[model samples]
Target: RKMSALAGRDNDYIFRQLLEYTSFTYTYILADPESKEAILIDPVIEMVNRDIKIIEDMGLNLKYAINTHVHADHVTGTGEIKKKIPSCKSMISKYSNAKADVQLSEGDKIKFGKFELEVRSTPGHTDGCLTYVWHQKNMAFTGDAILIRGCGRTDFQQGNSGRLYDSVHNQIFSLPPNFTLYPAHDYTGQTSTTVEEEKKLNPRLTKTKEEFIKIMKELNLPYPKQIDRAVPANMVCGMFELQDAKK
Candidate 1:
């Protein structure tokens, strides 16, 4: 199965890793030895066991499980993982429309181990969306807010082109050109992309704001069949409500 293969890759990628997981949607785990602290970002719930094993195997303690927003595609495994590692905190952006142990805003910094992640509110794909920037790696994780070759669609709940444009051009694109982008979704089948590459080659990016809006309206795609199920599950951090396992 696709999920199985992804799990294997995820584990293999973490040997000397700086907090990375690659389930259906990649879950990032960054740990620092001096602080004995670790943080999980935008993780898929199905890989909870793999993540936990990795955490314990390394003797690092988890401190945070952060979601960029209420997801429409994948379920967050944060809550389930939290139960496993009681000390870990759950975080999300205030705009996420979900309950959070910690609600972050743009420029908010979370310190753990040797890294500090600065939250950037990038709300084009979803109103409550967020992006995390690691100054050490010069890498940014844009959760569903932006993708390689494409960006998050603005056709669903609280979505709008005007806002998407503002979020992308003013907030996300403003970052330095060389920064590598690790998007929540990997539709491109590539490992990752850089800010400069997206700015130049993303078809949507090449158009003027007005043109981009028109194109999006004209190319309205079908609703995701799994959104109804995914959203509520994601809202609560991927816990099944007793009957979820049956589906």
Candidate 2:
């Protein structure tokens, strides 16, 4: 949805949330209305063309294509988007050990005109997970650290229940209670949640640290079917493997 941002100011920003059905991933496009500069987050490889078309139609200058972490569910579109929009650079966390044009760290700011997203490292689902915060807009893009009513599975990719617990409490929940949180994937139909909602209603996160860890340990979820292919491809930004992946 499109709306005005920054209270008491004459600011108009564009925001669109696109969903990739197969992986249940949410790709976000945020642009500055005045400058027409845009940034895309957590894009899936299969949706590159559609996303690019939207950017083009909107007359936005695609400045950055960013991933919250190295995803295991689907290949990233960052590399492919960069290829089509030569001016757009691919970005990820330096701790992710993934190749990208920009490797971010805590406190790093991704600026597209008057808009900026502050990076906060919140590793739990994976050691490189990052939550991007738009302070002016009072929103946070939470990759997989926290979900609508659940949290990311802490069973693989260096998943640590304790670390994940700390990350959520310290980084995300600490934001203003009114702040909206957008996640990478959601099994349920819900699209977004507020900090206050999760704080009081999240069954898993409401418990003590030790209790949260216990719950994570007993999830007994199945192994990810696509990890074998998705991981290697995602490491290099999902560029060279597109041909083989389609086969």
Candidate 3:
């Protein structure tokens, strides 16, 4: 979709942008038209400059840099954004054990301008995964918890197949069917999917809890390419100052 079409002025004052990075990871920029206040979800460090340019060009006042979870695939841009935009705070789930300006819990609302995102604690992917829902917009930022036709791998990082199944069924599938679900990563060129479609079509979620566990256990997916470096860096909000200093 066109960047301009990604966000626009409306009666509800919602401004949004969906950006894609090399890892098939998606970053979201949401703003309130009236206050011009914005928040970015799941930003990648490699795209920090690009994200900053968009915010500056749009005349937006970024208030928060939020992560859906402590990602294992890529480092976050939260620290870099905070360095560039001092007013913006970095936020992550309290269960993540990651350092950030704000440690959020379930039911916490993240406000930017007039928009408020209700935090739904949907762990089991990594124990700190969260889904941010905007009831008015009928949208949910699902991260890796629930992908297009699949769910996150429950092989490592405190992953539990049973808990993930429960989380999806109870926390996410419980939402309105029309709710548009935006996942953090999509490798097959797919952009978005609706809760209704996922509920009915998601291969991983459609199975019984026992079957799901069996499937997840047998998949044997490969580890992320950057997990070693990414996990450590992300724990500190992608601040590589010490690593850079070593060079």
Model 2, 180-240: lDDT tens digits are 9999999888999999999999999999999999999999999998898888888888877
Give the better candidate number (2 or 3) by lDDT: 2
| Tens-place lDDT digits, model 1, residues 55-83 | 77766778998887788776787878877
Question: What's the lDDT of the predicted structure labeled candidate 1?
Answer: 0.75
The best-first sequence of candidates by lDDT reads 2, 3, 1
Comparing 1 and 3 by lDDT, which wins? Answer: 3
List TM-scores for all candidates, in order.
Answer: 0.85, 0.93, 0.93
Model 1 compared with the native: what TM-score? 0.85
Note the clash tally of each candidate: 5, 0, 0
Span of 10 residues, lowest total lDDT, candidate 2: 1-10
Deviation from native of the Cα of residue 131 in model 1, angstroms? 0.9
- After superposition, the stretches of candidate 3 with alpha carbons farther than 4 Å from their true spots are 1-11, 15-17, 242-247
How well does candidate 3 score on lDDT at residue 86? 88
What would the per-residue lDDT of candidate 3 be over residues 1-247, giving only the tens digit for each residue?
Answer: 3343324645445445455556778999888766778899999998999988988787778899999998989899998998898889999999999889999999999998878999999998988999999987899999999999999988988899999999999999999999999999999988899999998999989999999999999998988898998888888888788446546
**Structural RMSD, model 3:** 3.2
